[model samples]
Target chain A: MPHATRIAFVGTPNCGKTTIFNTLTGLRQKVGNFPGVTVAPAVGRVTGTNTEAIDLPGIYSFAPKSPDEQLTVGVLSGMEQTIPRPDGIAFIIDGTNIEKGLFLFSYFAELGLPSIVVVTMIDEIKACGSTLDDIELEHILGVPVIPVVGNKGSGIEDVRLKLTDIKEFAVPNKLAEPEADIPARYTSVRNIAANVVASPVRDRRTEFLDKIFLHPIAGPTVFLAVMALFFQSIFTWATPLMDGIDSMFSLAQDGINTVVPDGIARSFLAKGIVAGVGSVLVFLPQILILNVFIVILEDCGYLARAAFLVDRAMGLFGLQGRSFIPLLGSFACAIPGIMSARIIPSEKDRMITMLIAPLMTCSARLPVYALLISAFIAPIYIGGFFSLQAMVLAGLYIAATLVGLLIALLLKKTMFRGAQTPFLIEFPPYRKPSLKNIAVSAWGRSREFLINAGTIILTLSVILWVLAEFPRANIPAEMQPLQAAQTQLEYSFAGRIGHTLQPAFAPIGFDWKMTVGVIGSFAAREVFVAVMGQLYAADVSENDVTLREALGANISLASALAVLAFYVFALQCISTIAVLRRETNSWKWPAFAFVYTFVLAYSASFAAYHITLFLGG
Target chain B: MNINELAVGKNALIERYRSNTVFSERLMELGLTPGTRITLVRRAPFSGPIEIAYGHLRLALRPAEGDGIYILPV
Candidate 1:
């Protein structure tokens, strides 16, 4: 491979910048935001014989105030002080909003950075009765205008071609800007567009949709409708796909069992690798689906609208107007939730957001909650639609959000010891969401998550299998498979470790098994179910070995209730811990989150279990 | 007061911001600059968020944020 030319991808939020990046780089990427920023940076190599592509933060302009956007300007000018600079910038302009998108391009030109323009959503432009003259644009900008229909990948190969043939160059065709006042820049850019372009007044559909969707009373109802649809999509809609994945892994485990020897090797093969990892992998479908919708909302520019629409109400919670995006992301996983906080801008506000974000009840907690509730209190009728057990799961999730926000409110009043930050939000122009863009982005993120799980989750599971699987001398051969495994687990390092501190959990009515599951969950909340699945059955996906049968056979309803309470209140995903460490640059929040969540989980579960039993009696 | 008491969607602009807050960048990113226009969209149940349109963008801004904007009618 020849020396990789420095290339950077830059644009505004939801501009399909990352999508374009992924279309270029696929899985060769790393994610980090600007230093001390939570808005994530997706750095990837568009590896080829000679070309390497770098995707930077999506910024609206070179005069960036947000730290997230600051990297955009810094990186393009070869002044990304913390990181390497780029040789060329591929400026992605939303096709329908060329005039507005040009604002940033104009900024890059003023800085004399060589840039190539890639027009995203060209299809949207045509549908809207507009056209971009790439030749004229190229002439005006003096850079090769690569007219890419980013959503269709109609000209992606061409974009790729130009990237590979990049050269060290300078821009001599940039427009000069006088003074540094930001308002002047907007005025000037608006003036520049007036001379060269004429599109019809506003699109009538926007006003039509806005009438009902943004209506006074009807507007909020519409918002609720849309959000409910989003939630249902996360839970019910993703189920079948998740089940399909679950089945494949189950079949694989069965296949392994058929050929493998039946002792330590069989147990480890069926239990540790398949069942353990399989349980975690089932959730990937939901993660991917969530990303699909998220990417669409972001690209179509409705996400900002939703943020603006709700900012007035969420602001009372001391969150920024755009907090909805990050908060919604939390429902999928807290890593993105914390990462999205980069948009908050203010140090105080951003920190508060990161602190409370983990409390949002990520989807990873759903399986554990479902497992416990189904085995314990699934009544004959649920909330009249969902199963009664499912309602409880939903209730627990909602309750966590309220209680967490309540705690944040209390903390902001005292511990934070800072004044309330003023907040504002922008609502960018409406545009058709690019399907190719959204698909590429979703696939990219899902790929990253699966990779993280493959390496981190696998290593931890192997190490955990060791902890649960040694000291053969301690167990008698005649015991049942589970009993034998339990004996070994009890004698193993993991079990001894659980036994050493058994007194602490005893108050919450936790058995050594529950203690072990909770400890294992430190790596991920979903791992709790996997641990329980392994502890209770020979393999997790064995049809007869449902979560119900496992917990039901050994533990009483009340103990099951305790476990439910434990998962509900405990913030136990290690990815969240890792992200918090990186975001806060400390061990403080994760440590605090673990300690307090354990405390809350224990107290809540203990209270729930005993109280339920007492009431029934 | 109803929106008529204020101008047609014009941002009230900041008078005095509460100190040590980092929300300025967030507001700026959202296109909530002073002298900007804000068109009220909708409100959810239980006194939830109010959706609004600003600078060709749309979202729900909390009432507290509106109050913080400290708008004086144009």
Candidate 2:
């Protein structure tokens, strides 16, 4: 068998390192159009070839200040046991910023490995009225210099063919020790850069956009406008798709009812299996829609500017600018939000961001809030433009965001009090986002959500179905169908448990039925609405009737508000807990998050119920 | 004067950092060493991070770190 060769692509952030790696290996590593997209190394083999490529996270130098940087350092230094040292290194250099790239490569030279320099974004350099002589650069750096426009796939064949005989490439001469001082090495890098690069001009396009996007007052206004559009698109665009999925599920349920006998087996098949699958599939549209916007914004480099605008506000919450992206993403779903927190360099800041993410009131909690608000709050028009009910909904969103920030502040003060990590970010020049890359990234994120969270939601649905189905009670033959369902659930395990636990939640104005819904929602936040619909025999599907009216006739305004308050703060989604466990590599932090949020939810609900009662609710 | 005091769009030569911390080391590693020509591009609103250019690289530095790097007007 021919020996397989592994090559590592390394470079500073925003240097198009991942782009070249993706081109060579044919693997789309999460849209390498922006910094922090490739926070972890992605390994893939060259299609139909024996060569493999490893795309490491971008780093400025061998000195590691962040976890991702440490991973790159560990792998390159042969200290990481899992990732074997590569046979060769592809030192990716940015054509526009060769000086900075060479400064890092000076450190790479000390590794003494067979190396090749692949210069990316050559077109960007030319467009900026600069010229780079790759032949001259090769002569000065003493390695093969291949200039490639990565996004256009030009010069990639040269890279692939070069990798076949990479072992024969001559190692660049080492000019300094591994621990050499930076300023001295940079002097040598400056001399080398002076030879190959001519008439370097600042990127005029980026500078022009920055004037408006980064203007003190205009910058924040543009950001807020963008955010409003982003969030509005999620609900406006996703509603039709969500409604389609809802009807499809209802049709399947009707099919089951007509085909199967009216008995326990039919109930299990229809309510347990079909409903479980439907619940999982219903969330796909919202997830896909949310990811589409995130991918575009990140690719265009606007997200970095948004972070810059919000850095001061985030500082008051003890988080740096990097934490804002993850938190903004949390409003869609905490799973993606938690995963995006990988971009944060500091471990403490990352953890704090992840811990408070659930409090942002993810889309999963939207149904619960909607059901409660529609039931209790009257849709009275205020000022002829705003509806009181809609205002209440907006108030809930604002409250959740404020509470999330406060929690971050509290965690910083008590648990993570220490010297602050430095906040340094590079401003990559804006480029038109690639449609294909954006599509692939959004699809990848949606697929990940389906696979990781889908199984847990499916399993929990079946478990809750069982808890509501067993220990069926005998109803009088003349009793109505709704009465029979109520009787069966009241006698079932979930019902009995709810009745037993009612006294504990009584202070928060929860009755036994609401208690059951709360317990069921621990599986997934939207399950509360489903459980309530089933218990009342009221259809909660799109354009369906009676659920809202039934709930309104039964519960008071105080209890409804208390329930809404509880949903705002509770960390009830098991998928989020599972993601937290995976991200932190331990159960301790997830357990802490769950316990503290639960305590906070209970206290907040108690306060809301009594305060409303005292106000003559 | 330090970087925080440098006017936007003005040029200067960087001097030694006031403190020998990791933050300063990282800035120097990014080629912000003494004797390098630097330009204060802009500062974020609310006295947030400041953007500076040296050679071909543009970096955003928090005020806390930017305050430590002294510069000589040129």
Candidate 3:
């Protein structure tokens, strides 16, 4: 029996660290938080080899700074509570940035760990008209430096072969302690450049893109245009796709109703099975579509550029450029978005950002938006090139941005009075995104949402289906067909609970049946669809209620808008709140987020409803 | 003297930050030594955090925290 030699992988951001990790470990990877910390750790065992690899968060130095950097420090220091430190450390460095990579090399040597230096980006360096002298770097750093491109699996076998046999390495430590005047470290690198490296011959296309992308006004304009395109695509381009999905679900539900017995079982199939779960499943297309952009934007260097472009606006509202990373997170759900506010150095800025994050209108709200767009704002040509639905979506997204920040800024000036955090954004050199990597990330995130949606939505949908199903003791004649197939749920406690809570929602323009769906949606926003589906999926007669009809017949335009508002502004996402709990180490943050978001959702819906009603005249 | 009064190129050690108490302690823990040397890098583009190159590190301290450090121009 042989023990797997575990190697810790480390590197700085955008230096192709993950590329090396993937090359070494392949798909034998799992990512999760280090114990007591929310930062994700990637651990993988090299396939077909007796080696395990742990991918640490990228860091510029070993010293602790921000939470991200601190996380890197913890893992390297073995201070992470959950997992034991790796047996060996693999320091991944970028080949082209040999000069910048050296600092980390010296830093890791101080940890006195048996280590291997995995130099990445060799192809990039080759394209840049330079090559690495692995021997020279080894001589300088007193460590075995394996100069290999981690992306193409080039020189990867050499790394694995070297790691197999552990040899004691000790060179008179060339590492220096933090000096008082390290300015010469910067100067010497410049001198080394003039003598050793040739004139630049690498492609300059990345710089060409960065020019407009990093421009003050121009960069933000490009970012806004990209966002506008994303919204328009989701709203209009997705319409046909969504209709296709809806029709499929409808047909599936119709088939189920016909085959099933005409009793309680059919009611459960209709209300619990179809109406509750199907409604949530219908929005998967829009959610999946939105995820495509998220994965690509993350892979492209554009997201960072987008962060840089919005840094000024963020700073004005007391947020750092880093806040943009998490606020953009609202496209998923705001709880985690708000929870991500922990990265902000200033609590005032963090709190302010947390308060506003839910306003971003996550994809969960898209179903309601799509429903509203179809019913009310359906297509009108805009500039002969755009659909009115597209325009409305663009407007909704823009409003989320503008109105959210306005309220954030206003709150800062009043209740959360505090100055903004200073911006210290790291602008990594942009590169064309990798396709396989982007696909992997999209698969990962969509899978995450699906897993969450599957379990929570399914349970709540079934629960709501039961509640809407009934009491045979006082069964009404019109609902007689619903009884023979009726299970204990028709007489269950949940049904009574829904009826009990029905009156409170009456003023807000929701029927008791809809109120039951709302109770079930508490676990997740998307569950509202499933809960609604499950409630209605039972209407399976020849004139059986359709999911769409179930929704449309039960809900008015104003109520529909109200549901959209509830999702748009409500801070009901459980995963997000869970993340927030971890980030702030306080219930206060999630509580504040929940309360404020609901206040915003409720008030906004109330206002939208009355205005909508007045216009019906 | 307070950091805000220090001239450019002056060195100051951060005593403690004040704006966000949570962040102030956090910064101190990140090696913002009370007697360490800190040189001003540059103020933010808009009136934001005052950037300081503190002891082999560059950090942007909000104005309130920027006021906590004490020093004299080098």
Candidate 4:
């Protein structure tokens, strides 16, 4: 090849193809979308080599069920425009499932391109007292068969050497005909396995684990426990890291305060740049922790089992099992949750999941909910265990969750109504997950989140800061600092716009000040607390009793509950909208999500406020 | 009988697919062609997907997909 040779790595899902790709690329990979498609595949350069490796989405056969599978086939067959056809193909096969691997390889061999077969998960096979004869297999298939432990880096150099030397790869002339029956291909694969695979033993350990993990009762129980652990780990473990990030930004603001005089530059530095970036990065810890669990669960082969366990319940709402994890992840943060939807092979299920993800009461909404509930709801003990305020907070979460699922069901019935896609998942034998692989995968996801969503958040923060800062009004010299600050805010552009929107927001019980708080929160959900504190000119925090009492004195219980209802359904976070746009590769879905959610928030809050007034609250 | 009708731990040989379509063809390409031996491993709780082992590979398929596979008890 005159130019740098591009080698495509193809394999079935859960065949360790990603592990091999990561091992070969070594943190040099970049994800880019295919031309005319939203499916983003990772492309990386082979370490110390000029060859480039493209990690295609894993598939079982060439059958194109989903858009991703169709894109994979398009790229492989050279029908795709932007991604030029690769000079060679690298077929990564799981050693434990040689027959299935070889079956797909037979099709790859027909591509008439020089190709090499790399057998992964050899260690798993060896632990079962079985071994693969790569040489004999190579002789039978008329190709090079290199067996390697992908995660452990065994035999990787040989594969890399072969990759660089594409001319040496065996280009099969004939095997199965284009229209050959499935039996014909399998017969050849079976005959080849007979000669090369010795002592093919069943993995008893996997069977034993399945007995508990897949048990009728134990299965669902364990799945619930695992999910609980997933949320607990991300929330409880990520707090300290998130707090560290939060304080680091505040310290930077303090330093800027001392050095930079009180002016536009100082405010820009402290609020627009520092606080904006901090708000975005504060989520990094939770994203990292969330990705770690996903990678571990997926790598260890339990994610499929998790899917299987939840398929029936998800099916009730027009989704399948795979939608559960993404929706579950949304409870932590919708950015990572929407990103995780890439794993759902079915387009319908993925879209429904992504659209409703923001309504799942993410961690960002916690402070706002805490503030509102504390402001209005009484803290009287309920049954000597649950406080009334705590119960109301939980009720808001439950209400949002139900509304999200209800919308999903409605979408499935209206927008995506049609024949359901088949759910066929391969259950790879359980193997010990690699920490290196988990770290690498998590790092990649976190990086993607920061880069793709971070820019939008930063821009929104600056704009909000400008809107709140401009059109300054002079304060009387004898006025208090807080009062002067409040007066300045009331004269700002955002405050004027809030006054303009008073008529529109009046039905939902929002005064001009509350409307300003709502507008400020569009940057992020938690910013509502800070905005309300600023509007009232108190050093506002979720735990500050001063701001709580101020809100209690000014805002009626009806308006407070209406605000809570509005937050529960609103897609206020721009980061979620950005991620949705990135994932869907179209403005249509994200735009629709924003419109639908705003309507929901408006109607729900209207009902809440009027109903409370009717009940004389 | 269909593969879904087979008892857990019972071995069966694939008779044929109930129909010829992309869905069934995909199953056939997964090494489930006629005359192959498969054993029902287990079923997920609350009538979820079913797991089956053929050769060294295990596959989880929803019952609707499983219904498309005809089987003969061995």
Which 10 consecutive positions of candidate 4 chain B have the poorest summed lDDT? B42-51
Look at candidate 4 and tell me the lDDT of residue A2.
67
| Candidate 1: segments with Cα more than 4 A from true spot | A26-40, A45-49, A123-134, A155-157, A167-172, A178-180, A377-384, A417-419, A429-432, A474-486, A538-544, B1-74
Q: Each model: TM-score of chain B?
A: 0.61, 0.95, 0.68, 0.94
Q: What is the DockQ (computed on Cα atoms) for candidate 3?
A: 0.10
DockQ of 1: 0.25
Over 4 Å off, model 4: A1-3, A165-168, A325-398, A414-421, A511-514, A520-564, A572-591, A607-617
Per-model lDDT: 0.68, 0.80, 0.64, 0.80
Better of 1 and 4 by DockQ: 4
- Model 2 chain A — which ten-residue stretch has the worst lDDT? A30-39
- Tens-place lDDT per residue, model 4, A289-313, is 8778878888888987888887887
Ten-residue region with minimum lDDT total, candidate 2 chain B:
B52-61
Identify the superior model by DockQ, candidate 1 or candidate 3: 1
* Candidate 1: Cα lDDT at A265: 90
- Model 3's TM-score against the true structure: 0.81
Q: Positional deviation of A359 in candidate 3, in angstroms?
A: 2.5
Instruction: List TM-score (chain A only) for every prediction.
Output: 0.90, 0.86, 0.87, 0.86
Error of 4 at A548 (Å): 9.2
